[model samples]
Target: VKSQHSERCIDFLTKELKVSNEKQAQERVLFVSARETLQAR
Candidate 1:
């Protein structure tokens, strides 16, 4: 069973955040993760 907000972050990114398609969606996650990784050093 999926929660009410299941995959909601993806929705926000694609809708309100205007991320467009899957490639753009994945890229956004990767970029943010990389930024966090660098900051943790």
Candidate 2:
């Protein structure tokens, strides 16, 4: 039972990490685009 609980925890953590990583990637893309636009001006 304890092992099962740990497994679930790990799964949840992995999912959370994936979500955060995706968010960071999106933000980085946005930042780069904004910088490019500013430099173009």
Best by lDDT: 1
Candidate 2 weakest lDDT stretch, 10 residues: 23-32
Candidate 2 deviant stretches above 4 angstroms: 16-41
Task: TM-score each candidate.
Answer: 0.34, 0.36
Model 2 residue 30 CA deviation (Å) reads: 37
The Cα error of candidate 1 at residue 40, in Å, is 18
Question: Each model's C-alpha lDDT?
Answer: 0.57, 0.49
**Per-residue lDDT of model 1, residues 1-41, tens digit only:** 13323356557778887857656755554323556679999
Measured with C-alpha atoms, the lDDT of residue 2 in candidate 2 is 43
RMSD of 2: 14.7
Give the Å shift of residue 39 in candidate 1. Answer: 24
Give every collision pair in model 2: none
**Candidate 1 Cα lDDT to native:** 0.57
